[model samples]
Target: MDLIIIAQAVGLFTVTNIDDIVVLALFFAQGAGERGTTAKIVAGQYLGFTAILAATLAATFGAGFLPEAVRAYFGLLPLLLGLRAAWKMWRGDDDDDAPGSNNGPALLTVATVTFANGGDNIGIYVPVFITVDHTGLAVYTAVFLLLVGVLCAVGRFLATRAPIARALSRWGHVLLPAVLIVLGIVILIEGGAFAL
Candidate 1:
């Protein structure tokens, strides 16, 4: 593996996954006290990212698996999640005390959200994948997976900070919904799902 290729892989992964830091941080805050939460999150992150890589790699191989238009629909996942959160707020259904109640299976929920949020990642990754040879592809995947672990660690560190965790706990319910809604809109627009 050339150093340039390694650098490119690192850069690409970092750029694509920058937003995931905050998402992971929020999850850490939410799962603060629960046993095995960190393990679940790390596993879910890997699961989700691996799926994204697989989809992108498959596309490179002429799998025709997920056209951009079809992938755009994945944005609906976060959009609906935001709407659901807003609905809960409207109905005065508090999730503060019951973190797990509305989230469904935590691991799957994280994985689903991660995958759904990866539409842009797929768009970026496929072009890069197309340019890379088999060895280069392996290098990229390794770098990406390594970065995922780093991201999880950083997210946990940030969430464990007193000020950061306190603020997130205080405002995350409102913030997460808005962020997800906006992210969904961005993904849809980027994918050309609809015009403004």
Candidate 2:
């Protein structure tokens, strides 16, 4: 049981590396001018991620089931989502015109961006839950949740700092698309599709 939990946690951690990069980019892009805003964005991201993890785990433990074929199909989801993020990054529309204009939109925008950016993680989680041992699923879920929360918090903290924030924000646009493209290629390879 412990081993299973550890394996699932490791898998979740592996899958989340790409997600962390994307979420960090999104927050950095949105909160370019105001470092304080990064906190809210990070909070919303973790909230959305928690919600998705709960839902996916529920489905996996409940009557829901995921076959190997479905898992393979889901493996492609990340690649597609990565492509979408790459496109969004290339378009340079990460800025929210109404971020500080109102609290509601600000929170919602953060949640929406986090959720949208997290699509790939959400997709892969279902399979991860299904394949792992039942007893370990809860622990795995908790570990993933905590990992994401910590990563987002650290990213927000780093982005809020003056020098780092400015430097990261300056190159965020270029970095975002490049990261997404590389993630997409890696996911494709993992999904048994050659990017070449």
lDDT of each: 0.80, 0.56
What does candidate 2's lDDT look like per residue over 1-196, in tens digits?
Answer: 6876776687767666555654464455545665466667667667767666765766676745443333334434334544554565556545343332212115554554445445456556777677767667767867776777667766667666777667656765455445544654654455454433
RMSD of each: 2.7, 6.0
Q: Provide the TM-score for each candidate, comma-separated.
A: 0.89, 0.56
**Local accuracy of candidate 1 as per-residue lDDT tens digits, 1-196:** 5799999999998888989898888878867877778898899889998999999999988899798778888888778777776677667786632223234227766786789888778888998899989999999989899999999999999999999989987877667677778877877777778952
For candidate 2, the 10 contiguous residues with the lowest summed lDDT are 96-105
- The top-ranked prediction according to TM-score is 1
**TM-score of candidate 1 against the unseen true structure:** 0.89
lDDT of 2 at 6: 71
- The count of backbone overlaps in candidate 1 is 0
